[model samples]
Target: MSGGQTQEQTPEAGTTETTPKRLPAAGRGGGGPHFNVGMPGEKSMNFLPSAKRLLGRLRPYRAHLMGIVTLAVFSVGFSVIGPKILGMATDLIFSGVVGQQLPPGTTLDQAVAQARAAGNDTFADMLASMDVIPGVGIDFTRLAQVLALALVLFVASSLLSWWQGYLLNDVVQRAILRLRADVEEKLHRLPLPYFDKQPRGELLSRVTNDIDNIAQSLQQTLSQLLSSLLTVVGVLTMMFVISPLLAVIALVAVPLSVVVTKQIAKRSQRQFIAQWQHTGALNGQIEEAFTGHELVKVFGRQREIEATFATKNDELFKASFGAQFISGIIMPSMMFIGNLSYVAIAVVGGLRVASGAMSLGDVQAFIQYSRQFTQPLTQVASMANLLQSGVASAERVFAVLDAQEQSPDPAEPARVTNPHGRVEFEQVSFRYEPDKPLIEDLSLVAEPGHTVAIVGPTGAGKTTLVNLVMRFYELDAGRITLDGVDITTMRRDELRGEIGMVLQDTWLFGGTIRDNIAYGDPGASEEEIVAAAKATFVDRFVRSLPDGYDTVIDEEGSNVSAGEKQLITIARAFLSNPSLLILDEATSSVDTRTEVLLQHAMAALRADRTSFVIAHRLSTIRDADLILVMESGRIVEQGTHSELLAAEGAYHRLYHAQFTQPVAEADGGDAESDVVGASAVTGTLRPRSPVG
Candidate 1:
């Protein structure tokens, strides 16, 4: 059975009180300020550690990563050379235009000296810097070759970039697939108590939303970050080759951009953590509201639920807005810094060009390289937001994977063959919390082929008793044995395989009715399923429907009545044909007539099988071989029905309270007559109608 605490109730002295384990307001794995909603706080994960761990998940894909990096390098190399090649073409055109204007057969030095003597010093200085012949015109052939080389380099760069992106995507997908599988396996390895403390929606978010966020973050940031860093390095190198002075001026923006990005990212990281936290919290609230919507409307708490939802939604909005607003500052800040460096480089490069210290083509190419350098820095800063958000999600997922797992199964498991269904609890001690003892040093025995009925009030540890028998929880002390074999010595699966349970709250997945019934024993044949359904009285109602057993159950099973759902669950248990059966208020949802029919069916099912039946309705257990009345997690009374009633102990009182009531005398009647009437009723007492 799924683990849960019973509803809150004040316990008398010497009685056990089962309540949910409370988490500290800021505890790890506990919800934040809104702990009731199951949200983790901002401190749940460290950014650097989580990011390192996330990257470590890709260690197995080293070869693929190396290939991607090599591709990025080649891609950036080709792209960086394009601007320089285009600049060479510009220089060729300029030299050719100047040489065509020069006189043929006149030395360039003579022309430059004449210009200088004619008071054209600036033009003469520029001419002196040129490598043009006196009578040469524009070289169309060389210009075409340079332009063609630039085009080829750019196309090659684009092809390499596309291939790199494809490889990165493939690597990320495969890594995430392994991560998802690990999470799934980890969930199964965790004990039932682990789930008891976690909210359903919060866990679901960790498995679904957080994982997808991690995948998206990796997909968007990995390739872009690699390419952007490479671009920055390649562009910076080209800038230095073109003009060292301008390259140094462009370097001034690097530190400033890093500072701006770092400051904003630090602030935004907390907000992103809070945002995802509230998202899980809000999802938990929404799940609760929807699951209990019928109860909420019945209790007239729609307004209350709506108010709570709005409050949580507002919290999510605040966190989301803060996160986006903070991270959003990175782009414009980096851009502003880059623009400053651009202006400074442009001014310095223009002066060098005018003084003939650098050619006009080199100045233009340097300007282009400076732009390329800053653009990549801006991209890297922008990717910081995604990287931070992804790391936050990765931390959440890692928490689950790191959770304490249930004790391992025995290496050499004890096998039970031809099981006799003899279950014994010897000196068993257990409690959900250390300070609160529910069951201690308890011992009980159920002989093979006997029906044992356990009766108790709310929070009396009745279900806990059955849970221990199933080994859903480990014992704190002592041991339980099945067929003379210590249950802990056997594998949990092999132990549970011998027992079948029919819980009060039935569960049905989205599938055909036949499939849900066959879930008990997947290998069951069609005839076997029909036989089990018929024995449980499920076939009668199912046959009345148009599709009979083929009818599809919706996710919520809304089309099926509560009684029908219970019947389906009962049929499932019956189909398992186990040596032991546990019926936990199995007939609580059926009509009195159906209850009578189910009782007969269960009696047959229980025949020759060791069955543990937990019920509050006394009438259902009257025919059991042994009836145990439990109080405060101890057996207060145990005997046959008649024997317990004759003893007039706790069991007798419970029976009288349920079966006998005071009779009201008519108006003007004597008090003695009322007393006599009430006595007579007690003598001829009858059980109340069973609850449906």
Candidate 2:
């Protein structure tokens, strides 16, 4: 089942149940990391993973990332040099004052003339040699030199911007693509049972939303961190070299900022983790509604659905708001601290300048450097919130990637060849949970081309038996065999290829009817598809439609009637032409007329095909080669209809009591009763139960 977006994807996008020729092995899909088994909710978490571990994905593009880093460094260097030149100009301007030294143009010639009138020979003589130049007049070349350095720094800064932007963007995109593919592949590898505990929305969030956050983190992490670090270091160097006193004062507030940052980051990280979990729950509610809308309507659960959805929706809102709120405060708080430090540095620098202990230029330069130092520190602190979220997201992603495969399967899968329809259950047993076994000491055999029928009440392990044959769940004891070979030894794909199944619940993909039929036999020709359709009674209904086989069905074949869906699935099986077939309640939903038609069609298709029927109506399976009656995970009795009826045991009582009941039909006619007045035998009959 899918949403409105399903229209865009392939109709057969969901299940890969098909007749793919068995390969030597199944690909784990990608060579990327698995995020399952132990990561997110696991006991063993690698919280402090090595730098090497974090950089694993970037290893392939090491050269490219290095180029980006280099550009970032160059860009920061240029930007950092701008303030230095400004400070140098300031120093040069004031150094000549206090009679420190004359740098050609510092003292105006007019001022020197006044000093000469006052008999100040040193100042006047220094001004006499000053050569006038354009722009600032005397000594224009030195001023030009300062402006040229500024231009060089500006150009370097721009180039660094372009390079870092391009490189970081490319790296982030590639990383995200690989991560998506890996997550998708791992989802496919996960066993069906794993789905029983996990919700679809949570899984989707890990792949789509959470991984996206991680990608964003990767995008900013390298360029911003490297540049910020370099800027901080450069600023600190300038501050220390200019005036150690002011530098010491500027450093005072850093520890306080670090402490506050750590506290905020911890809160943000926790909130982010909660946000993802709540989002998944909300998504699951939506998915469940869309998939089971019809069931909801049938059960008259509109109010219940709304209540459930609203609860999850509220939880998501609170969690997301909390996360954003906490993350939002980090930047302002960091800026506040930086501003406070700025005021302190300015006040302390002013005193040093007033006492003549430092040049006004040195005081100004120290204040400028102090600001430069705080800027990067503020940024790194603010961005730390986003980075923390990356950690939480990575934790979920790694959980799925780390799951262990069910069993030790060959790296190169071995394919089965020329399978016969023969199957035997050799004292097989199974249990999904330790306390409750679904099947026990079950033994049976179906020879080639034989039709075996199993009938029982619900929970009788009826469905569990067929699942064992398919190895959907592992066997707890004993073994099952196909053509005298241990079934597990033959590769899952090869063995599954030889078996065809028609489930009671019809799930169709979005596609033309012909494509749907071909899904069972990927190579089936149009002729084979049509023939199979005719054999399964789907052709009769299909031909009546204007488009016939060309008609497209909605997802899960929701466009068709239930019986039509069942017949189409049956057609799929017929097209596959597998030697063995499992008809799991094929007639459960259809009216008696359609049931009768399906029965005849099934009979014709079963010729030369080994078939197993999990039948509900006793009369429908009377002629089966063998009948099995199961109870409480054990087969209580089995025989031909007459033989079981004569025995008057568990099977005899269950069949006649459950299947023999009759009532007037739509035409007000009495149907022939299946029971020979034997419902009273061994109390009421318990219909054959589905295998666990």
Candidate 3:
């Protein structure tokens, strides 16, 4: 409404592609397109402050996170000890064997046994004793001490790892649990237009598949990543201490691998983003097919649907393989580079030791450090896809969460007490699209205990009026008054509470029939619910069900017929006992028998309340009240059926063409029969008293 556009039928929403149409960041880090590389997605590109806001959720659980960090440190600390001890063993065995070929005061067999025993000591003890005496030959006791501590560290690593898993599981699961609930609540609170814009599959992906990614990434993959990182750090530190030259030489592989990894990961990230989008499109196709299966079968579009699915499925498969193939190449390549680095170190360090420039112990420690550095790097490189994919999913989620909310009602809201059901449209006009008013300068009034029937073509804005009555969409001009109080000033929830609406589509959740009858009015007693059901004629057929009121209804009430679904909706409206009732195509799809029953039920529901009926059947509301015959967006004629028929105007032509079907002569002579499709009233009309 704020924009100057004459008509904006499909308004773009949320942080959409508003930038100067970024020409898909040239293939592979500006490599001029031949390399077939993909650009990094919005992850490292966008600034989403809402994500930073969501991080506040982690604050309360900081203590638990700190503990996880400590446990990880301890676990890595223990894990690194094993390799360090092996290096010490190597050094002790190599030193003991050189020149002397054993330890002091011992034969070959005795010296070998003593050296082996010394290699088993704690490395710390070995270092301490070595510091005490320069050039001391060998000590089997120190080696023994290092080996014993290494064994203890290995066992401790295992214990700490188990604890890490247990605690991480509890924390991540609970975090996701809270997050899911919060998201669901937000979904409920968001405006209806938001749902209309987003595809059902995309929304479903957020609730289902997207959350699943978060769980896997945070729970298992993240733990592996963290531990691997720590392992790399610990090994690198020790390697540097052993020999800075070797440490620097071995790390050539690390930076090179990271550069390569970043390139490959970018491609993989794009592929994964494509994969998720394609998956959603595929799911959308499937859902659309299933929902409209009846129409599809009737129209014989099964082959067409299948072809659509196959095309989407192929795209999904290609995306999946492309992403996995790139990500999969990283680890093995890292390992290859790692092996080459090891060979380089083995050659270079062997010479340094032989020349007595570096100790054999130092060379061993350098190799140990190399593994520590390489391992976590490899692990991180491999996890690049998961991390990026998670970010892609986050972007989609934030897109939803960041959408502008519905406009709120005035702070000083008006209230209607024991409303008389009198409604007046005071110069009311609405435009879902700007300047293309659906209901232009529309004005009408419904008196208490009177029926106001609106008859119009499919897109004539008939349903829009009903929606406005319920305040589902705000009006663009003028005010709608309920019992002389401005509807806009009233709290939306309160305003809706006084109106009962029967929509074209009848929705039922998975629950007992009784439960659905009391859906919004859950405080109602079963007896009251049954009474309402009977009043709506739902009780008539529900009694025939296997379990009657207790029947376990499937979600969407899929187990029921269109007629029964309609009756259920009517029953729900009856239970509400609102002051104003609206029926939009209430019995459009029902058979004559069900329509009659629905008519009677609606009569009961409308008793002592003003009602608005968007009808296609003239026989349903022929007894009395006014009819507003709509053409395009305006009310062209208004009057009772007989008066309009007598006047021979728009209502008359419509009545003859759609509603006035000849029926078997009743006791009062000829009568009009009910028919849904033939209920069209002409677009033009003659003037008459607007109300019966």
State each model's CA lDDT, in order: 0.82, 0.69, 0.70
lDDT of 1 by residue, 1-692 (tens): 21113321112223232222222221121122122422454474577778989999999999999999999999999998888888888889998998999898989899899889999988888888878788889899989999999999999999999999999999999999999999999999998666655667788999999999999999999998998889988998888787888888899889888888999998998899998888887777777778776776787878887887898899999999999999999999988998899899889987787677888788878888888899888988998888888998899899899988989999999988878788899999877666678787889898877889988665667877888988878888999989989999999999999999988767899999999999999999999999999999999999999999999999889999989999999999999988889988888778889999988898888777889988766788899989988887778889999999999998876666455434333232334433343444345333355999
Candidate 2's error at 71, in angstroms? 1.7
Compose the digit string of candidate 3's lDDT tens values, residues 484-565: 8898899889999999887665677899888888985889998899898888778888989889999988875778887787
TM-scores, all candidates, are 0.91, 0.81, 0.83
**Candidate 1 RMSD to the correct structure:** 6.0
The Cα RMSD in angstroms, rounded to one decimal, for candidate 2 relative to the true structure is 9.3
Error of 3 at 679 (Å): 10
Q: Is candidate 1 or candidate 3 better by TM-score?
A: 1
Over 4 Å off, model 3: 1-57, 95-144, 409-412, 659-692
